[model samples]
Every structure is written in structure tokens, then in C-alpha cells.
Target: MNFDEQINKLIYDWEKHAMPVLRGVAGVNSLAAVALLIYRYGFFLTEEETADLFASFDLIFLIFGMVYLTRLLFQLDRWAFIKSTWLEGVLNLFIIIHGAVNYFFGVKLLLSLSLMFSDANPVLQYQHVLSCYLLLMVMTEVTKLSTHLSNLNIKPATTFIFSFLLLIGIGTSLLMLPASTVGPHSMKTLDALFTAVSASCVTGLAVVDTGQFFTFKGQLVILFLAQVGGIGIVSFATFFATFLSKGVGLKHQSIIQDFLSSEDLSSATQLLRRVIFLTLLIELVGTVGLFFSWSEELVFDSFGQKLFYSLFHSISAFCNAGFSLFPDGLNTSILSDDTTEFAISGMRIDIRRMYGLHMVVAALIIFGSMGFTTIEEVLSPSKIYDRVKKPWKDWRIGTKMALVSTALLLLLGTLAVFILEVDQLRHDKTIVEALITAFFQSVTTRTAGFNTMDFGSMKDSTIIIMMFLMFIGAAPGSTGGGIKCTTFYVLLLSAIGDIRGQKNIIIGRRAISPTVVRKAYSILMFATTYNVFAIFLLSITESGNTDIGILQIAFEQVSAFGTAGISMGITSDLSSWGKVIIIISMYIGRVGTLTLALALSSTVKTNSFRYPEEHVMIG
Candidate 1:
């Protein structure tokens, strides 16, 4: 045989014989990586044990390098293969270079870089890099595994619900580890589960003080959960699979379309990519903005701490997950005191206000709550270009509806809060400061869960207004949760149509579909029913506590159901059963009421024979 023919035969033989083994090995390695990471971060290891862990990590990297090299060697179109797996290729190349340098020169490249950039311990920084690399590897494996989920014959809604449950499970386990808490002992199971649900659902409610009770490692776990939960597990899995693989299968795309609320299955993958990119892009910009916006008075132990705070709050705000590093949330006295006392328009305003930081966080919250689809339509480069080319182009009806509803809610909530608390607000702060605080509260109450003023101190009327806002919550398909603004808007439109004696509900010159209107009402009814049941449960569970009233119980129930996370100083004092009830409420809220109903209810096809339609009694 010719030399070329011989090489081809050998390559084909290697692929035929070794590829399956390699795939199995890769799966094992991914699982090993996850285990190693859990051990490395989740425990307090002795010096010798730490050394052994690092050694194990290096060995894993070496195996990964060998596997990549073997695959590269057998590929006929090496360039195409490398391009398809560029991210993995780059990581593998870095691992190889780091390994070579450590072996040949007895110097760790990551440690050296850590020393150059940070004042923290070099070894610890090096471990962080390795942990991050392992995390990436784990996520890649997860995405690969997710592609096989279609074979399980589960509905897309069921898959979506299961994804969050899986995330919460993993997060709970991680948070319960010894190293995750400030105390020597691990977090209690209930607290860990509650925190995990809050983070995974992006609800931001916490039984423990996030800033004081958890170590930095624990906070990191929460951050990861919030980010993944914000974008959604399905989106992460599908995006990674599509980005790394040659292409996504039809099944993956079909599932992704439901998650993204995309009508066109062909563009589901593209929308997923855009959503992820936009999310990260917004977060990065927010981080930079927050870093600069922090008042000089607010001190950190180190630059890394400062950076982490910025990054954490940025993700939390953008996710509408109000997990804060501050003990008292945004209303922490320290944060308010950190701001400068300034004057505006000849009015001497001596009161301190978190103007810059609050505004930045509010903006992030607003953007996140607007939904990815709306964000894409408004901010995407292609859309901008199209709009520029065609000035007459209008936003989709959904976008218009979301925008209008959000604006109305924000305006109404702001005015209501301002009016209700005007005397109390003006007693302690200037008009401008009061206005800013009112605005921030309005922006956060819907879904962000941030508080500039103490909820316990607010008037009952103001609390009612906040609850109304929370009930409506954010836009559909957004990170934040509630019945959703679209649902709220649709119901309002339907009400208006009925009042006007019209057969159809119209908005933006387009008739709303009956199916959509029905779904909207279904969500509302489901949400109301759940909230009522949850409030009753909470009332029964906490009946022994004299400090807790029905108003507080009801407020807590609605907050959990809306995933708003605000509470009247009651989260930490809840009984175990109360926490469990809240946990269920958060889960139902995060996965929409309608989505859970769909997931639980089986489809029943009707016979071809028609039956007479019946009218329902009026409310």
C-alpha cells in the first residue's frame, strides 16, 4: 500500500477501535474532576492533603491533554476539529504549557501570575484557577449529558423543572460542606436547602445572614447558582453543546425553543447564544460600573475582596436575585453612610444616599426583568442595524406590552411609595434623597428584592403597594419571577375589553389570542390559589409565635410566591415547616404557575365529535 493509504487505514482503525474507549474515559474524568473539586473546596484539608489534591489535579490535566492530543491526531480535518472545539483546545493547550513549565522549571505559572497580580497567598490563588478549570470541564460534561435527556421521553417543561431541582440539590450539598460556613460545623440541612432554593430560584430570600454566616467559598457557591439559575440550566446546557459540538440536534433545539420562548425553532440556538452573550456582557459592564461606583468610605480587606463584591452584586442585581454581601441588604447603614453629602439646585441635602450604586443596580435589575427576548429585540446589533435602515420598524407587540407594563408599574409604585411614606421619608432625608430611595424601592420591589428602607418600618399601605408590584413581577421569560408582566397586562386588557362590551382584547392594534388570554388567566388563578394555600399553611405553622401577625404571614407568602425575597424581618424566625412552605412557594414562583401546571398535568386529546360550548358564570 502507498504511504498515504497506509496512514489513512491506521487512522481509521484507531478511530474505530479507540474512540469509544476514549469517550468513556472522558466521562470518568469529568466525574473525577467534579469529585476532586468538591473535596478541594468543600473541606478543610491539612497541608499534606492539600498537596495530594493538587497532585491529583495535575494528573487529571495531563490525562485531558493526552485525550485531546489523541483525538487531534486521528482527525482527518484537524483544522475543522480544532475550530469546532476551540475553547477546549485552548484550555488543553494552557494545561500542557503549565504542566511543562512546572515539571521542567519547577515553577508554577499560575502561582507566579497570582503573586504578580494579588497580595493573597499564591497557593490559594493557584487552587482557584485549577478549580475554575475543573468547573468549566464539569459544565462541558453536563452540557454533553443534557443532549441525551431527550431520549428519556420527558416533556420539555418537566426537563426545565428538573434542571432547577438538580441545581438546587447540588447547591444545597455544596453549601452544607464544612468549608462553606464561617463556623467549624457545616450549615444545617434545612438552611442549606432553603438557601440553595433561594439562590437557584434567584429568589434572594435567606434565613441566615449571607454576609456573616457564610464563608467566601459559600458565597461563591451562591453566586454560581444565581448565575446559572438566572440564565437557566437548559440555556447553559444547550449553549455549551451547540457552541462546542458540530451542531445541536433537532431535539435540543426543540427543547430550547420552549425555554427561550422562541417561535422559530431554527433560531433557538442563535437566540440561546445571544441571550448568554448579552447576559455576560451586561454583567461585565455592571461589574465595572459597580467597582467604580463604590464609595471610598466602604472598605474591603483587599482588592480581591472589592472585586468579588462588585462581581457578586452585579450578578445578583442582573439576576434580580437580591443576595447581598451586606448584612442589612442595600439598606445597610454602612452603605448609606458611605455616600457623599451633596446639594442639588440650591437645596442643601445633608443626607447620604447610595446614588451611583443604587442607580446602577436599579438599571441592572430593570434590564434583567425585561426578559432576554425583549432585550435582544431592543439591544441586538442586527436589530439596531435593521431599525436604522428602516425607521418605520416597530417593536413586536409583546415587547411593546412588556415595556408599557413595566413603565406603568414602576411609575405607579414609585408614586404610591412616595405618597404613602412622604412624611417619614422627608423627616430623615432631603426631597431628592427621598425621591431616589422611592425610585429604588419601586425598581426592586417588583422582583429584585433590594431594600433601601426597612420594610418593617414602612406603613401598611406602602407594604400593600409593594405586594401589588411583587405580584405582577417581571416580564415573561425573564430571570425574575411572578405571574409576569405580560400575564398581568393581558388580564388587564381582557378586563378592559369585557368592560367595554367587546369580544376581543386588543393592544398595539393587534388582537390577543384567546389561547394566550386563557393561559394568562390560568397563571393568575394558579398564583392566587397557591398564595392563599401557602399563607394558610404559614399561619398554621407559625401560630405559636405572638410576634407574627396575619399581615406579615400573608406578605411573606406573596413574597415567596412572587420570588420577590423581601420579608418583614421574619425569614430567620420561621419554623421548619414554615421554611418548607416558603421553599415550595419559591419553586412554584420561579417555575411559573402555568409551567408547573403544564408539567404536572397530562395531555388529554379530545375525540373528533364536537360538543356544545357552555358559558361560565360571571365573577
Candidate 2:
């Protein structure tokens, strides 16, 4: 046979003969008997004696690092390793143990450290904890990216859920541990789960003052949760594998690529490599800029403090999570505080200087807000190389839609907020400063929730503007919330199509698919339905509030649901049920309102043949 034919035959034979053999033994999970034995026997230890158990965790991680290293050296294919003979199956037990113990112990270490938080200083404690979690998160995300970049079949989302669930289990176990005298009061399961969810979700709406509720340990735990949740644990796994191994399997690549998303047929490894690289690039630059920007005022503090602040804000901003160590968030009060203050604190800025910082921060927010798909498409090396070579080359449709929509949204958002706030400039500065703050507020309103002024005092018109910004949200597969710019683009385009009597919505000379149009419309409809429902639920749960107050709550609820964290100073006053509603909204917002819906939507086989066309009544 010819070379191509021979290769195809080889692949066909391998899949036919080899894959099933491996599947029989290595499909999923460890031996049920071994797991049962461990569960049955492993829970007999007391807290006082468990130090050794955790210590073993460190060793197990070291062993995994070594085994994966050895596997790298042998250059054995993932399929070869996964489908090893029965003799090698004996060793697979150790492989499973190594992976499991390392994961278990690593998770426990974080949970234990959180339980030991002292009251000495929450900022200091959380700073340290957030660092550790970021390190771990980056490691895990890298591994995830590496696996996906290398392979196309490994499931990144499933892996992410598994790792997160593992951490939750560890957190639950930690909450059950004996209460420390220095830590905040004991955690009820619901509260602990709530705290964990908030961190993972990266939503800052909390029942307790994250600052004072937990001992330094408790807050640190929360910080770790935020950092982990913010960057995506799968991305951490992807980055970790990158540092250790030279290449990833295609199956692993598929998993990571699926999560990062992209255009055309780019490989997952290339996509993940860029994603991890871009994440670090933005964070490092942001941290350095923040540190230097604040260095003059924060000189009296320890070196660690400045670094932690830089790191915390960098990750938090890029994640598009509106978490702040400050209880009131990035309020005017924080602007005056030396520690957690904005970079502009105490340093008098000329209008020009103010403009520069405004531009810099706005750029960072924009970069952070851009979706993974946007980054992969517009900024990726291959696309960049092609574009450089071919100046007239058209951008990918997603990139075009994202960039155009984001710019328009920001411009419209800025103009609307400025018009509303023109008469309400309550700050001390020239008209330039008012513009700067308004511009920042405009950018922040779309879901970053980083504010320079009080949102509570805004005009009713301003509240409506803020709601629209929050509802439109960031681009598709991005960190921010809303209906997503892509959805917005398609819906608007579809409307335009109807107005023009076109068969399909067209953009940049390309016909937008009906499937895409339908999905976008569905997302918009569901978002509207859900927001109304959230308002109804909140009104019932927190009845007796003013009309304005109700509107504010409704606005914030939708924002949170969109993963847009803008609040009108009412987040702190939410009732328990109200808080739960907000929490659910935040979860849906981050995971995506439509993403959750799609996940819940039934998946079934489709006919290969075309369906007969049918027309329905007009809207």
C-alpha cells in the first residue's frame, strides 16, 4: 500500500484491536475494592495524628512529578502507556495511587492552612494564601492545557469539575475539623460551601465580611479559593505540564483546546501555550506596573505586602472577578487607604498623568475582558504571522465580531455614563478628572466592578445605562459576564436580516448559520426570562425595600448572573435567601447563563438527512 494508505491501515488496526483492550482495564476510576478499603480504613485517624498523613501528601506529589517525568523520558505514546499489557497493569495501580495521593494531599494542605488562619492581619494572611493557590492553580491549569494541547480527546471541563469537586470535598472536611481559637467562628456546611462557591465563582457577594469574618487563616482560605477559581484550575494543570514536559498528547490537547476555545482547526497545544503565556504575560506586566505605581506610598510595608497586592489584583482583574480584600470593594474609602488604595493615592497627578494611568488601567481591563477565543484568534502567533504576511487578510469572524462589538459597547457605555454623570461630578478635580473617573466607571460597569465613585448615588437613568452594560457583558468565552458580545452581534444582525428580508444574517460577506442565530436568540431570551425571574424571587425574599432599592437589587442580581460584579451599595444588605439567589446568579454568570442552559439541554442524535422547511408566525 502507499504510505498514506499504510498509515491509515495502521491507525485503523490500532483502534480496532488495541483501544478496546485498554478500555476494559483503564476506562475510569481505580479498583472499587481498593477505594472501598481505603475509605473504610482511612477515616480512623484523629486530627492530632494526621500531620504525617499530610506530610505523605508532599512525597506523593514528588513521586508523581517523577513518574510523569520518567514517562516523558521513555517517549512512550499516551495510548501505549494507557493501553499497556496486563503485566504493566500491575504498575498502573501505582500510577493511579501516585496521581490520587498527590491530588488529595495537595488539596488538604490548602484546606488545612485555611483552617489555621490567625487574626494577626487578614491582608497578610490572604496574600500568602492567594500566592500558594495561584502557584497550584497555575500548575494545574498548565497540566490541563498541556494535556489538551497534546491530545484532542481528554475532557478539560470534566477534569476541571473533578478537581474543583475534590477541593470542595477537602474544604468540607476542613470545616469539620476542630475550630481554632484564633480563626473566625466555626463554619456551618452551608456557609463553608457558600464560601467555597463564592471563591470558585469569583463573586465577592458574601454573607460575612471576608476581611473580618475569617481569621487570617479563614480569609486566606477564601483568597486561595478566589485565586484558584479565578484562573481556572484546568489552566493551572496545563501550565504545570508545560514547565515539565516538552509536548502533550493530542487527546490532552483536545481537552484543553475545548476549554480555551478557538477558530478554524488550530491545535489545542498551540492554543494553550498561547493562553498560559498570555495569562502570565498580562499578570506579570500588571503586577510590575501596580507594584511600581504604588511603591512610593507602600515603601514602609514589607516587600511581600506590595508583591501580594500586585498579584492579588492582577489575578482578580484578569479573571474579571470583582473580589476585593476591602470589604466595601474598590470604594472611595479604599482610595484614601495607603495599603489597598488605588495607585493614584497620595500622588498628585497632572491631568496628563491621570490620563496615562486611566489609559493603562483601561487597557488592562480591556485585555482581561477579551475572551479566550478572541485572544487565540486575534493575538495568536500563527494568525498574527499570517496577518503580518497578508495585510489585507480578513480577520476571523469571531475576532471581527468580538473586537467591533467590544469597542462599540465600551464607547456607548462611556458616552451613556458620562451623559448621566455630567451633572453629578462629586469628585474634586478638573473636568478632566471627572472624565477620567467617568471613563473608568464606563469600562468597569460592564462587569469588572472596579469603581472610582459611589454607584449608589447614581441617577435612575445611570442605573439603566449600567444595567444595559452589564446585560451586554464581555465577549464570548471571555472572563466577563452578560449575554456575550457574540450573542449581541448575532441577535442584532438577525434583527437586521429580518428588517432587510434576508434569508440569513450576513457579516463580513459570510452567512451566519441558523444554528448560531438560534442559539444567540435563545441566550438573549433566557437571560431576559431569568433576570425577570431573579427580580421576582428577590422581591419576595427581600420585600419591604424601596422601588429604587428593588431596581438596584434587580440590577445587581442580573450583573452577578452575567458575572458582572457591579453593585449599587446594596450587596451587603441582601437577606440569606437573597444572597443565595445572588450566588446562583453569579454561578450562572461565570459558567455562563446560556452555557448552563446548554449543559442542561438534552443532547440527542440528529438525522443525517435534511428536514423539510416550515414557516412559523412572525414575532
Q: In lDDT terms, how accurate is model 2?
A: 0.61
How high is the CA lDDT of each candidate model?
A: 0.86, 0.61
Which one wins on TM-score?
A: 1
Model 1: how large is the Cα RMSD against the reference? 4.5
Q: Candidate 2, which ten residues in sequence have the lowest lDDT sum? A: 26-35
- Give the alpha carbon lDDT tens digit for every residue of 19-47 in model 2: 44433332221233223223322244554
Candidate with the greatest lDDT versus the true structure: 1
lDDT of 1 by residue, 1-619 (tens): 9998899888988897787787788889988988998898889899899889888988788888898899898998899999988888888999899899999999888889888998968778878887888788767666767778767877778888888999999999999999999877999999999999999999989998897788888999999999999888878888888877777767678767876678799999898899889899999999999999887655555788789989999999999988988777887764323322211223322213668888999999999999889999998999999999999999999899889999999999889989999987899788888888899889987688788888898999998889889999999878889999989899988898888999998887898899999998888888898898888889999999999999899888888888888989999999999999999999999988888888899898976898899999977
Give the Å error, residue 40, model 2: 24
True lDDT of residue 468, candidate 1:
89
For model 1, name the residue pairs that clash.
none
Which 10-residue window of candidate 1 scores lowest in summed lDDT?
342-351
As a whole number from 0 to 100, the lDDT of residue 355 in candidate 1 is 81
